[model samples]
Target chain A: MTLPLLQVRDLKVHFQVRAGGIFFANYLPLKAVDGLSFDLAAGETLGIVGESGCGKSTLGRAILQLLPATSGSVAWLGKDLTALDRAELKAHRRHMQIVFQDPLASLDPRMTAGDIIAEPLRNYETGLSSAAIKARVREMMEQVGLLPSMVNRYPHEFSGGQCQRIGIARAMILKPKLVVCDEPVSALDVSIRAQVINLLMDFQRALNISMLFISHDLSVVRHISRRVMVLYLGKVMELADRDAIYGAPRHPYTQALISAVPIPDPEKERAKPRVLVAGDLPSPLDPPSGCVFRTRCPKATNICALTVPVLESAGVGHEVACHHWRD
Target chain B: MSASVLDLKNLSVRFATPEGEVAAVSELSLSVGKGECLGIVGESGSGKSQTFLAAMGLLARNGRAVGEAIFGGINLAAADENTLNRLRGNKLAMIFQDPMTSLTPHMKVGHQLTEVLVRHRNLKFPAARDRAIAMLRRVQISEPERRFEMYPHELSGGLRQRVMIAMALMCGPELIIADEPTTALDVTVQAQILDLIRRAKEELGTAVILITHDLGVVAGMADRVGVMYAGRIVELGEVHQIFNAPQHPYTKGLLACTPRLDDATASALVTIPGQPPDLQQLPTGCAYHPRCGNVMERCRAAAPPLMSTGGGGLKACFLENFGSVQAGTVVP
Candidate 1:
C-alpha cells in the first residue's frame, strides 16, 4: 500500500504564558493546539477553519517545523519529520514551503520582486548560473499572470493584489510538494481576492501540489478544500468532506458558525432561522475543562462538563468530537 | 414624496500625493431618504469611503473637495468650521471601523458618551449621565451601569463597538454614517452589531449610509446599493435589483466572483482578470473597460454617462441590454 503524503498524530503545541499578578508571577501553559491529527494525500487540499484564537495558524507553522511541537509525530513520505536533526530538516525544507497572510510584510522591502523570487532558487541550488535563475523567475512570474517587465519594481510600488501574486511566485519558484497557505486572500480587496484565489487553484491543478489551507472564511475554505476541519479553542470540533461539513454539520458550534454567516441572498436570509451562539469565545489561556466548547454549546448537559469527548466517527467519512452530536 | 434627508450633487475629491493628483471621487451624486439605509460596496481605493467623507467635511489634510451637499437647507460642503462643529455629532454622526481608535483610551465610556449630549443638548451633568446610560441599555449592552464606569480598553471588542454605537446615537442624530462597522468583528459578533444597527433604523427612524465590501452584509441591511469602480458609481439600484439583475459588467463580475454559501458544491469561483485601475492614471472612456468582460470598441473610445434605467436605478455601460437577468460571460 502507498503511504499518505503527510501524516500527523497527536500534535500538541503549548506556550508558557505569564499568569497571576506581578507580586505572584507564575507560568501557565496556554494550550494553543491541544491535539490534532490528520493526513494529506499527494495532491489533496485540507482546509482548517476557525476564529481568531482557534490556533489555525499555529497548526500550520507546527506542520512545517517552523515552531517546535510540544509533542507529536509528523511523518512525511514515511519519514518522521519531528525526529529529524537541524541539518537533515534543512535538506528536506525544499519540499515544504509557506505563504503568509500579509504579502508586503512577509517580503523583504529592499529587494526587487525579481530578486526575491530568485533568492530561493539561488539558496537551494548553488550551482545554477545567475542567467538561468533570472530566466526561471521570469517564467514563474508569467505563469502567475505578472508582467515580466515589472519584475524590477519594489514591493512598495505594487498594490495589495499584485503584491500577493509576487508572493505566490516566490513560494512556487522552488516547486515544492506542499504549501501552507495562511489566510492568503484575507488581506486583499474583494475583487482582487477572487483573482488570487483562482490563481492559487490553477497552480494547484497544474503542478499537482498539496496545500494545507488555513483561513477564517468558510465560503472560501469550502471552495478550495476537498475535506474541511472546524477548530474551536485549539481542538477539532468536526472533520468531514466539504459537502458533508457544510450540508449537515453535527456539532452545535459548527451549526451556529455556519448559520452565523450571512448569506448574500436577501429572500433566503429573511426566511432562514438563525442560530446565534451567545457570549464571546473564552480565552485560550484558561480554556473550559471537559468539552472545550461546552460553555457555548446549546445542547450541553451535566455530562459534557464531566468528561472530555474524544473524536469519533459519527458517519462514513465524518468525525465529530461532541458527546451530544445527534444526526 | 418627502424630500431626501441628504442630497449630493457633482461631488469630487482629489488628493495630492507624491506620485501626482489622484481623483478619489469624480462628479458623484447620491442621496439618502428618510429612514433608509444606503450601502456603498467597492474594493480598496474605489472611493466609496471618500464620497461620504467629503460630504461630512472629514477629508484628510492633503485632500480637497468641490461639491454641493445640501442637508437641512444648508450646504455641508460649503459650511464653515464653526457651523460644521455644531452640526457634526449633533445632527450628523459617524462610526469608524475600529472602535478602539475612535474611543479615547484614558476616558471612561460613560464620560465619552455624556460629552456628546452635554455639548449638543446643553444638558446638565446629571441629565447627560442618565441619557448616556439609557443609550447603552438600548444597544443591548448587559450590565449597562457597571460598564458605564469601565475604560475603553477594559471592554471586549463587541462591547467596545456597542459603546461606540451608543455614543454615536446619544444626541439622536438624523443621519448616521457607519463605515465598515462590523468588518473587524467575528462572525457572531458581526451579526449582533448588524442587529443593533437595524434596530436603530427601525425604532429611531434614522437614515444610514453603510459602507462595506461584504455583499452579504449589504444584502441583509441595505435597502439600496451602489457599486463603485475607479472613483465612479458603476451601478446603483435597489438591493434586490442589484443582486438579482446587475447592470454594469463590473457589478456582475463582482457578484459572480464571490463564493456564495448557497452554492453547496461549486467546483470553481469566477474571477475578474487584470488589476483594478489606478485612479491617477485611469484609462480613457469607461474606466472598467480594460477588465470588463462585455467591453466593446465604443467603450474604449468614449465615456458612458450614468443613464437612468427608469426602474429607480442607474447604469453606466455601453451595452444596450445591460440589466438582463442572464449572467454575462467572463472574458479571460
Candidate 2:
C-alpha cells in the first residue's frame, strides 16, 4: 500500500568528452550510467557494490541530481526531481541529503562543527532563532554519540572517524528522509572503520532513514543493506536481497567478488579456490555493446553479444541481467 | 635454519624531529628464514614498514637505525652506502606498496627490468633483455616480449605492480621484503598477485617478509604471523595459532574489524576506539592501554612485555588470554 521512497526509471548519465581536449571539439559521450534502474523503499538500505570507475558513485550523484542527469527521471516521494526547477530542487535538498566519500574534503576547515551542522538547517528554515539553532546542533551531536564539548572544535581536531561522525551529524541535522552514503568508511583504519559503521547503523535505526549506500567493500554492504545490487561497467549485474546476494550470489562476477574477500582463517584461505578475473575492466567510453559484462563474463555466449539482457527474475525476487543465468 | 637469511635483533628506528627523538620501531627483534613467508600484520604506524626499512638499510637520510642487523652473517646495521651496495638488490630486495612510483616512467618496461638485472648482476644487454622477458612471463604478464617494449604509462596498475615484483625477484635474492605489495590492487588482481608471490617464493626458495593491513591477505599468504602495534611485536606465532586464537587485544580487534564474507549483513563492522598513539607521545605503560577495553590496573602503569601465551601464539596483553571467536563486538 505504501509507495517506494525513491523510483529511478532507465537512468542514463553520459559525459561528452572531447577527443583532444576542448580544442579538438570531437564530442564522444562516456557511458558512465548506461541504463540503470532500482528502487529504495522507506527506511530500507540498498547497497551498490562495484570496483572504482564502474559508475557506482555516478549513480548515487545522479540520483541526488548533484551532477546533471543526462536522461531518465528520478521521482522522490511524490515529486519528479528531474523536472524540478533549480529553486525547487534546492527547496527539496533538505529531504534528500548525501554523506560524501571523503570527510576531509566534504567538511570546511574554516567552519566549526556546530556551524557546519547549522548551515543545513539555516538554509532550509529561515524563521529559526540563532539560540534554537545551537540547541539543535548540540542535540544532533548527542544523537550521533558526540560529546557536547566537541561542537566548537575544528574539523582538523577530529580523527578520520570523528570527522566522519561530524559529517553524519551534518547530514542528519536536517532530518533527511533519504541519505546517499558514498564509501563512508573507506578512508578509516580497520579498527576505527568498525566504530563508524556501528555509528551509521545506530543513526539509521533511530531516524529510519532510507539510504543508497555505495561502496567497493562488499562486506560493509552486506552488513547494512536489505537489498543488494551489483554494478559492473555502469550497469546493474544482479539485484536481490542481501542474504541471497552474499549467501548465494548468482552472477559469476558477484561470485568472484565474494570469493576475493580475504577471510582471516588460515584453513579457509588454503581450502578456498580463488575465482580469478583475468584482464582489466573495459573503459566506460568504449563499453562493449549487448551485455556490458560480456568482455569479462566467463559465461558469455553469442546471445550475450547480440542483444542486451534485461533485468528479469532468475529466482524469487532475484533479478539478473544475464542470459547465462539458470543455464 | 638457512642461517636466518635476515635478522633484526634489538632493532630500533627513530626520526630526529624539532621536538625530540620519535621511536617508530622499539627494541624489535625479527628474522626471516629461507623460503619462509613471515607476515607482519598491523594497522598503520605499527612500525611494520620501519622495521623492514631499518633492516634493509633503506631508511631516509633524516632517519636513524640502531641495534643489531645481521643479514647473511654480515652486520648491516652500521653498513655504509658502499657496504650496503655490496649486498643490495642481488642478495636482498624489496617491493613497495605503489608500483607506478617504483618503475621509471621515462624508460620502457623491459628496459627498467633489464637495468636492474644489469646493475645488480652485471649482465650484458642481450643476456639481461632475455632474462628480463623471461622474468615478465614468470610473473604471469601476458605478451611479455611485446609488453617489454611498452612504457610504464602504457601498462595498467596491475601490470606495473607485476613489473615491480619481477624486478625485485630477478636476481634470486635470499630474502624479499614486500611492504603492502598488493594494497593498491583490486581484489581479483590482489588474489592473483598473492598466488604469484607464493609461486615465486616456492620456486626461488626465497624468504619473504610481507607487511600488510588486510587480515584476509595476511591469512591467505602468511606462514608465520607477527602483529606489530606501537613499534612492538604484540603477538607472533604460526598462522593457524594466531587466526584461530588471537591473544593480543590489538590483533583480536583487527580480526573483528574485517568484514566477513559470511556475515549476514555488511553493516555490523567492529570499531576500535581512538587512533594509534602518537609515536613520540606514547603512553608510559602499554601503548594499547588507552584504547584497550580489558585494561588491567598494571596495564595503566607498566607496559606488558611481549610474553608467550599459554597457547601456541605469543601475546603482550596483561589479560593473559581472552576474546571469543565472535565475528565482532555486536551483530546488527
Candidate 3:
C-alpha cells in the first residue's frame, strides 16, 4: 500500500492551567486534544469540526508542531515531527503552513502585501534574488485573485477579503505539501467567504496539497472536505467520509451537531427533525470519567460512564466512538 | 396582517464620522405585526442593526436618525429620552449577540433580571425576585435558584445566552429586537437559544425583529425576511419566497453564495465578485451595481426603487421578470 502523506497516532495536547485564587492556586491539566488519530492522503482535505471549546484548533496546531503535544506522534512521510527538535523542525516547516482565522490579525500591519507573501520564499529559498522573490510574490497574488498592482499596499489598507487573499498567498507561496486552514472564512462576509474558499480549493487542486481544514461551520466543512471528523470534549466522536458523517452520522454528538446546522431552504429547515443534545460541553479541565461526551450524549447510559468507547468500524471507511452507535 | 406593533416609515440613520457623514440606513420602511418575526438579513455595514438601534433610541452620540418609527401611537424616532426610556424595557426589549457584553458583569444574573421588572413593571423587590427566578426557569437554565446568584462570567456561553433571554422575558415585552441573539453561540447551543425565541413568539404572541447575517437562521426563525444591502432593504418577502425565489440580484447572489449542507457536490461555490460596499463612499446609483451580475446602464445611472414582485413581496431591481431571466443573459 502507498504510504499516507500524514499519519497522526494517539496525539494529545494538554495545558496546565492555573486554577483557584493566587494564595491557593493549583494546576489542572486541560485536555485540549486527547488521543486523536487520523491519516491524510497526498491530496485530500480532512475537516475537523466541533464547538468553541472542542479543541479542533488545538488538533490542527498539534499536527503542525506549532503547539507541543503531551503524548503520541505525528508522522509526515514516515518522519515523526514530534520527535524533532527546534532546529530539525525548522527544516520541516517548509513542508507545512497554516492559514489563520482572523486574516487582518494574522498579518503584520507593518508588512506590505508583497513582503508578507514573499517572507516564506525569503526564509526557505535563501539563494533567490530580491527581484526573483518579488516576481514570485506578484504572480501568487494574481493567482489568488488579488491585483498584482496592490502588492506594495499595507495590510491595513486592504479589505477583509483582500487581506485573506494575502494570507492564502503567503501560505501557498511555500508550496507546502500540507496546509492547515483554521476557520479561514468564518470572519469573512457571506459573499466574500465563497471567494476565499474557492481560492483555497483552486490552490489544493492545482498543487495537490493535503489540507487539515478545521472549522465550526459544518456547511462550509461539508463543502470543502473529502472526509469529516467530529470532535467533542477533545476526543474524536465520529470520523467518516463526508457523506457518511453528514448523511448518516452514528454518534449521538455527531447527529446533534449536524442537526443543529440550520439549512438555508426555509421549507426543508422547518420540516427537519432536530436532535438537540442537552447541556453545554463539560469543562476540559475535568471531562466525564469514561466517554467524554456521555454527560451530553442522548444515547449515553451507565455503561458509557463506566467504560470508554474506542473507535470501532461501523461500515466501510466509517468509524464511531459510541457504545450505542448501532442503535 | 395582524395589528401593526411597530411601523417604520422611510427611516434613515446617519453617523457623523471623522472621515465624513456615513449613511448607515437610508429610506428603509418596514413593519412588524403582532406575534410575527421580521428578520433583517445583511452583511456587516449593511445597516440592518442600525435601523432598529435608531428606533430604540440607542444610536451613538454622533449618530442622527430622521423619518418616523411609529409605535404605540408615538414617533419613536422623534421621542425624547423620557418617553423612550419608559417604553424601552417595558414594551420593547433587546437581546444582543454577545451575552457577556450585553449583561452586567458586576451584578448577579438574577439581580439583572429582577431589576427590569422592578423598574419597568413597578413590581416590589420580593415579587420581582420570584418572577425573575421563574423567568430563568422558563428559559431552561437548570437550577435557576443556584444560577441566579452567579455572575455572568460564571456561566457558559449557552447558559449566559439563556440568562440574557430570561432577562429579555422578565417583563414580557411586546416587541423583542433580537440582534443576532445566537451568533456568538455554538451550533448546538444556538439551536436551544433559537428554540427559546420561537417559544417566546408562539406562546407569548410577542413580535420579534431578528437581525442577523445568517440566512439559515432567518430561514428557520423568521416568518418574513428583508434582505438589506448598502443601507437599504433590497428585498422584502415571506421567508419561503425569499429563499425559494429571491427577486433582487444581490439577494439572489447572497443565497447562491451561502454553502448549503445538502449540497455536498464538488461544484465551485457561486461567488458574488468584489466585496461588500463601503458605507462612507457607496457606489453611485445602485450601491450593488459594481458587484451585481445583472448590472445594466440604467442600474448605473438610477437606483431602483422597491417595486412589487407580484408574488406578495417587494424587490429593488430594474430588471423586468427577474425570475424568468436566464443567469448570464440579464447583463445585456
Candidate 4:
C-alpha cells in the first residue's frame, strides 16, 4: 500500500504551567495533547471535532510543528518532522500551511492584501520578478473570490469575509500539499461561512491537498471530512468514517456530541432524543484517573475509573476508546 | 396570540458616524407574547441586537432611537433615565453574548446577583444573598453556596453564563432579552444553557427575546422567528412555517447556506453570493437585491413592504409563489 501523505503517531504536547501563588508556585504539566495517532492518505480530509480546551487546536499546531510536541512523532511524506532543526523544518514548511481561526487578526495589519499573498512566493522563489509575483497574487485574489482591484487595500479596509479570503490566498499561494485549518470559518457570519467553506473545498479538489480540518462545529466537520476524530481533554474518544461517526456513534462522548447539535429543522430537532451530558469539561492539568471522560460520561463504571481504555477496533475502519461501547 | 409582554411599533435606530448616518434598525415592528420566545436572526450589522438595544434605552452616545417600544404601557423609546432605571432590572433584563465583559469583574458574582434584587426587589443584603444562591441552584449550578463567594474569573465560561442567567432570573423579570447567549459556548454547553433559558420561559412565564445568528439555536428555542437583513425584518413567522416553507428568497438562501448535521452527502454548501450590505450605504430598494437569486427590475427600483402571506406570516418580498419555484431545488 502507498504511504500516507501525513502520519501522526502517539503525538503528545504537554505544557508546563505554574500553579499556586508566586511564593509557593509549582509547575504542572498541562496535557493539551496526550496521545493522538492518525494517518492521512493523499488528498484526504481528516476532520478533528471537539469543544474548546479539548486539545484539537494543539494537535493541529503540533502536527504543523508550529508548536513543538513534547514527545512522539509527526511524519510527513515518510520523513519525521520532529527530528528536523529550525532551518530543516523551514525547508519543509512550504509543503504545509495553516489557516487560522480569526481572519482579521491573522493578517498583518500593516501589509496590503497583495503583499500578504505575495510574501510566500517572495520567501520561496527569490528569483521571481516583482511583476510576476503581483500577477500571481492577483490571480489568487480572484480564485479566492476577492476583487483583483482590492489587492492594494489593507486588511481593515476589507470585511471579515474578504479578510479571510486574503488569508486563504496567502495559505494556498504556496500550493501546499497539506493545510491545517483551525476553525477557519468560526469568526465569519453565517451567510459568509458557506462561501469560505466552498473556497477551501474547491482548492482542496483542484490541488489534491490533504487537509487537517479542526473545528468545534460538527455540522461543518461532517460536510468537509471523509474521516472524523472526536476528542475530549487531549484524548481521542472515537475515530471513524464520517458516516459511521455521525450515523452510528459508539462512544458515549461522540453520541452526546452528535445529539447536542441542534438541527435547523424545528420538527426534527424536537423529535430527536437529546443526550445532554452534565457538567463542564474537566481541567487537563489535573485530569481524572483512567478514562478521562468518565466524570461526565453516562456509562462510567468502576473499571472505567481504574484503568484507561485504549482505542480498540469496533468495526471496519472504526476505533472507539470506551470500555462499554458495545453495550 | 396571547397578550404581548413587549411590543415594538415601527421602531428605528440610527447612528451618526463620521462618514454618514447609519440606519442600524429601520422601522422594525414585532411583539413577544408573555412566556413566548421570539428569535431575531441576522448576520453582523443586520441590527438584530440594536433593535433590542433601542428598546432597552441602551444606545450609544451618537445613536438615536425613534418610534415606540411599548413594554407594559411604558414607551421605552421615550422613557426617562429614572423611569428606565426602575424598569430595567425589575421588569426587563438582558443576557449578553460574553458574560465576562457584561458582568462586573471586580465584584463577587453573588454581589452582582444580589445587586439586582436589592435595588429592584427592596430585599436586604442577607435576604438577597439567600435568593441569589437559591436562583443559582435553580439554574443547576452545583455547589451553589461555594460558587456564590467566587469571583467571575474563578468560573468557567459556561458557569459564568449560568451565573448571568441566575442574575437575570433573580427579580423574576417580565422580559429577558438574550443576545447571542450561547455564541461563546461549546455545543454541549450551549444545549445546557438553551435548556435553562427554555425552562425560565416555561416555568416563570417570562417573555424571551433570543437574538442570535445561529438558526439552529433559534429552531429549538424560538416559538416564532424574525429574519433581519439590512436593518429590516425580511420575514417573520412561526419556526415551523419559516423552516418548512420559507416565503422570502433571503430566508430560503440562508436556510440553504447553513451546513446541516443530518445532511452528509459530501455536496458543496450553497452560499448566498455577495457580502452583507453596509449599513451606512445600503443598496437602493431591497438591501438584499444585489445578492438575490431571483431579483427583478422592481426589486432594484423600489423596496417591497412587509405583507402578510395568508398563512399567518409576514414577508417583505415581491416574488410570487417562491416556495413552489424553489421546490426540489434546495439541498436537503
Candidate 5:
C-alpha cells in the first residue's frame, strides 16, 4: 500500500497565555489543539468543523507549521515535518499552500492580480523564466474564471467574487499537492459562494490535490469533503465519512452541532426535531475534565466527568470519542 | 392582515459617493403587520439593510432618503430629527449585527436596560431597575440579579445578545428591525437567539423585520418574504409560497445555491454565473438578467416591474415561465 499522502499523530499545540496584571502575573497554558490524529490520502478532502474557539483553525495552522506544535508529529511523504530543519522545511513548503477566510485581506492591496499570482512561482520556482511565470499566471487566471485583461487590475477594483477568484488563482498557481482552505467562502456573499466553491472543486478534480478544509459551516464542509472531523474545546469528538457523520453522527456534541444547522425547507425546518445543546462553549482555558464537551453536553454523567474517553473505531471509517455513544 | 403597524411608500435612499449617486434603495413600498415577521433576503449590495436604515433615519451624512415611511400614522420618512428622536428607540427599535458595539461597555447592563425604560417610559429608578431585571430573566439569562450588575464584557456573546434583546424590549416598541442578529454567533447560540426572537414575537406581539442573507433562517421565522436585488424587491409573498414556488429567477437561483442539510444528493452546488451587481452602475435592464439563467431579449432591453404573477406572489421577470424549471438540478 502507498503510504498515506499525509499522516498526523497526537498533534498538540499549546500557548502560554499571561494572566492577571503587573505584579501578580501568572502564565497559563492554553491547549489550542490537544491530541488530534488523522490521515489524508492523495486527492482527498478532510474537513475540520467546530464552533467558535473549538480550535479547528489552530489545528489547520499547526499542520501547515505556520504555528509550532508543542508535541506529536506531522509526516508528509514519509518525512516527519516536526523534526525538519529550516532549510528542509522551506523546500517542503513548495508542496503546500493556504487560502485564508478573508479573500480581500489575504491578497496584497498594492500588488496587481498578475503580480500576486506570480509571487508564489517566483519564490518556489526560481529556475522558471519570467515569461514562463507570466504564462502560467495567465493560465491559472483563466482557469479560475478571471479574464486575462483584468490581470493588471488591483484587488480594490474587483468585486468580492472577483477578488476571491484572484485569490484562488494565486493559491493554485504553484500547483501544490495540498491546500489548506480556511473558511474560504465564509466572507463571501450568498449568491457568490457557490461560484467559488465550485471553482475549488473543479480545481481539485483537475489537479488531483489533497485539501484540509476547515469551516464552521457544516453544509459547505459536507458538500466538499469526503470525511469530516468534529472538534470541541481542542479535542476530537468524532471523525467519520461524510455521509456517516451527517446521517448518523455518534457523539452527542456532533449530533447537536449537525441538527442545529437550519435547513432551507420551511416545512421540514419547522417540523424537524432540534437537539439544542444548552449554553455556550466553555472557555478553553478551563475545559471540563474527562470529556471536553461535557460542560455543555446534554448527556453528562459522573463517569463522563471522571474518565476521559479515547478515540475508538465504532464501524468501518467511523471513529468516536464518547463513552455513551449509542451507534 | 392585522392593522398595519408600519407602512412604507415609494421609499428611495441615495448616497452621494465619489463615483456619482448610488441609489441604494429605489421606490420600495411595503408594510409590516402587527405581530408579523417580514424577512428581507438579499446578497451584498442588494440594499436590504439600507431600506431599514432609511426607515430609522440612520443613514450616513452623504446619504439622503426620499418618500414616506408611515409608522403609527406618522410619516417617518419626512419626520424631523426632533420627531424621529422621540420615536427612534421608543416606538421603533433596531438590533444590529455586533452586540458589543451596540452595547455601552462602560455602563453595567442593568443600568443600560433601566435607562431606556426611564427615558422612554418615564419610570422611577427603582421600578426601572426591577423591570430591567425581569426583562433579562425573560430573555433566559440565568442569575438576572447578579448578571444585572455585570458589564457587557463579562457576558458571553449569546448572553450579550440576550441583553440587547432585553434592551430592545425595554421600551416595548411596536416594531423591531433585527439586522443579522445571529450572524456573529455560533450555530448553537444562533438557534437559541432565533428561538428567543420567536418567543418575543409570540408573547409580545411585536412586528419584526428580519434582515439576513441566510434563506434557512428566513424559512423558519418569517411570515412574509421579500427577495431584493439591486435595491428593488423582485418578489414578495408568503414565506411558504416564496420557498415552495419562488417566482423570480433570482429567488430560484438563491434557493438552488443554498446547500440543504436535508438533501442527501452529493451533487455540486449550482452557481449563478456573474457577481452581484454594482449599485452605482447597475445593468441597463434587469439587474439580475446578466446572471439569470432564463435571460430573454426583453430582459436585456427593459427592466421588469414587480408584477403580480397570479400565483399569490409578485415576480419581476420577462420570462413567461420564470421558475418552471427547478434550479440547481443541473449543475453545469
Candidate 6:
C-alpha cells in the first residue's frame, strides 16, 4: 500500500468546563472529538460525513492544530504535530491550510482580495519582497477564476461564490500538500456550488494535493472524494471508498444519511420508502453507552446497546461499526 | 367537474427595484382543486414563490400585481387592503420557508397561535389557548402544553416550522398556501414535515399549493406539478406525467440535473447553463430559449402562450403543438 500523506491516531479534543472554586475544584470536559483515527493518502481526497454537532469540524481543527488537542497524534510528512512547540508549529503551517464554511467571515473586510491572499505568503516567506508577492497573488487569483483587475476589491464587494473562490485562492497560494476544506461550498447557491466544486476539483488535479473535505453534503462529497468516513457523536461509524459509501452504504447510520439525501427525481423518490431516523443526534458530551447510532438505528438489537461495536471489515476496504451487520 | 378553490388567469407580478421595474411573475395561469396539492418547482428567480405569494394577497407593500385571481367567486387582484386583510389569515393562510422570519421571536408560541384563533375564528383567550394547544398537538409537536410558553428561539428549526404549520392551519382555512415549507429542513425531517402537511391537509380537507424548488419534495408531496421559469408557468400537469414524460426542453433540463442515491445509472446532468433570466428584461420569446438545447428561430422571437397539451397537461413552448393538441380547453 502507498504511504498515507497524513496519519492521525487516537486524536482527542476536549473543552474544559471549569467549575467549583469555593470548596473543591472540579473540572468537567466536553469531549468534542475523542479517539478519532483516519488517514489521507498522497493526492487523495478523504471526505468526512456528519451532522452539525458530530465533532467532524472539531477533528479537522484538531488535525490542523488550530485548536489544542487534549491528546493523540497528528503525523504529517513524517513529523508528529502533537509534540511541536509554537515556533515549530508556525514553521510547519505552510504545508497544511484550511478553508472555513463562511467565506465572508474568514476574510478580512479592510483588506483587498489581493492582499488577503498575499498575507499568508508575506507572513511565512519574509525573504520575498512586496513586488514578488503581488505577482504570485495575481497568478493565484487568475487560477481560481477571479479577474486580476478585481484584485483591489474588498470581501463585501464580491458575491458569496466569488468570495469562496478568493478563499480557495488564499488556501491554495501556500501550495499546501494537504488542504482541509470544512463545508466550503455549503453557504453558496446551488447553481454556484457546482461552479466552485468544479473549480476546486480542477485545482486539486493541477496541484495534486490531498484534502480532508468535511461536509454534511453527501452528493458533493461523492462527486470529488476518493474515500469517505461517517462520523456520529464523535465516533467513526463507517469508512470506505466513495463508491461503496454512496453506492452500498454498509452501516445503518450511513444508510440513513445517504437515504436522507433528497433525490430530485419524482418517480424514483416516490418508488423508494424514505428511511427517516427519528429524534435529533445524541449530544457528543454525553454520548450513548455503546454503539453511538443504536439509539436511532431501526435494526438495533439489545446487543447493540450493551456493547460497543468496533470497526469490523465488511468487504474489501469497507469498515463499519454496526453491531449487527447480518441478522 | 369540481369548482376550482383558487384560480389565477394571466397573473402578473412586478416589483419596482433600484435597477428597473422587474416582472417577477408574468402571465402565469394555474389553479388548485378543493383538496389538491399543486407543487410549483423552479430555481431562484423562477418566480415559483412569487406566483403563490401574489395569489395569497401577501406580497410586500411595494409589489404590483395584475390580472385575475378568482378565489371562490372573489377577485383578489382588485381587492382592497381591508378585504385582503380580512381574507388573509382566515380565508387564505400562507406559510413561508423560514419559520424564524414568519414567527415573532419575543412572543410565546402559544400566544401567537392563540392570536390567530382569537382574531380569525373569534374565540376568547381561554378557548383560543385550549385550541392552540390542540393545534400544536395535531402537528405532532411534543409536550404541547409546556411548549406553549416557550419562545420561537427556544424551539428547533423543525419544531418551529411545525409551530408555523399549526398557526397557518389554526384558522382551518379552505386554502393553505405553503411556500417551500420543507426547504429549510433536513432531509429526514423534511420527509416528516411533508408527512405532517399531507396528514393535516387530509384531516382538515384544505387545498394546498406547495411552492418549492426541490423536485424530490414535490414528488413526494404533490398530486400535480407546475414547472415555472423566468416568471411564468412553462409546464403544468399531473405529477406522474410530468415526472415520467417531460416534454419541454427546460423541464427536461431540470429533470436531468438532480443527483439521486439509488440512481447509479446517472447521466451527465444537463444544467440550464446560465442564471435565471433578468425579470426586468425577460427574453422576447421563451425565457428558457437561451439555455434550451432544442432552440429554434421561432422560439427566439415569439412568446409561447400557456396553451393546453392533450392528456391534461399545459405547456408554453413554441416548439410544442399546443393549440392543435389540447383542442380548445382553457387553463382556468
Task: Find the candidate with the highest DockQ and give its number.
Answer: 4
B1-332 per-residue lDDT for model 5 (tens digits): 58999888999999999989999999999889999999999998889999999999999999999999999888887889989989977889999999999999999999998987788789999999999999898999889999999999989999999999998888888999999999999999999999999989999999999999999999999999999999999999999999988888888889999877777766778877778887877898898888877777888889998889897778788777653644533445
**Of the pair 1 and 4, which is ahead by TM-score?**
4
Any runs in candidate 4 off by more than 4 Å, and if so which?
B324-332
Instruction: Encode model 3's per-residue lDDT on B1-332: one tens digit a residue.
Output: 68999999999999998898999999999999988999999999999999999999999999999999999999999999999988987899999999999898999987898887888888898898889888888999889889999999999999998988888887778999999999999999999999999999999999999999999999999999999999999999999999988888888888888899978786788888888888887888899898877788999898899999999999998988686532221110
* Pairs clashing within candidate 4: none
The candidate scoring highest on lDDT is: 4
RMSD over all Cα atoms, model 2: 2.2
* Candidate 3: pairs in clash: none
How much is the lDDT of residue A292 in candidate 5? 88
DockQ of all predictions against the true structure, Cα-based: 0.64, 0.66, 0.73, 0.76, 0.75, 0.30
Model 6, A184-300: lDDT tens digits are 988765555656776777767788999999988777777778899988878889999988888888888888888777666666776777787876566555678878788888998
Per-model C-alpha lDDT, please?
A: 0.88, 0.85, 0.91, 0.93, 0.89, 0.81
* Chain A only TM-scores, each candidate in turn: 0.98, 0.96, 0.98, 0.99, 0.98, 0.95
Candidate 4 global TM-score: 0.98
What's the lDDT of the predicted structure labeled candidate 6?
A: 0.81
User: Given candidate 5, what's the lDDT at residue A182?
Assistant: 93
lDDT of 1 at B112: 93
Interface RMSD of 2: 2.1
> Candidate 2, which segments miss by more than 4 Å at Cα?
A21-23, B265-270, B321-332
Ranking by DockQ: 4, 5, 3, 2, 1, 6
Ranking by lDDT: 4, 3, 5, 1, 2, 6
**Cα lDDT of model 4 by residue, A180-224, tens digit:** 999999999988998899899999999999999999999999999
lDDT of 5 by residue, A1-327 (tens): 999989999999999999777998888989999999999999999999999998899988898899999999999988999999999999999889888998889889999999999998988899999899888988888888889988889999988888888888888888889999999999998878988888898888889999999999998998999999999888999999999999999999989988889988889889989788888878778888988888888888898999999998979989999989973
Interface RMS for model 1? 1.5
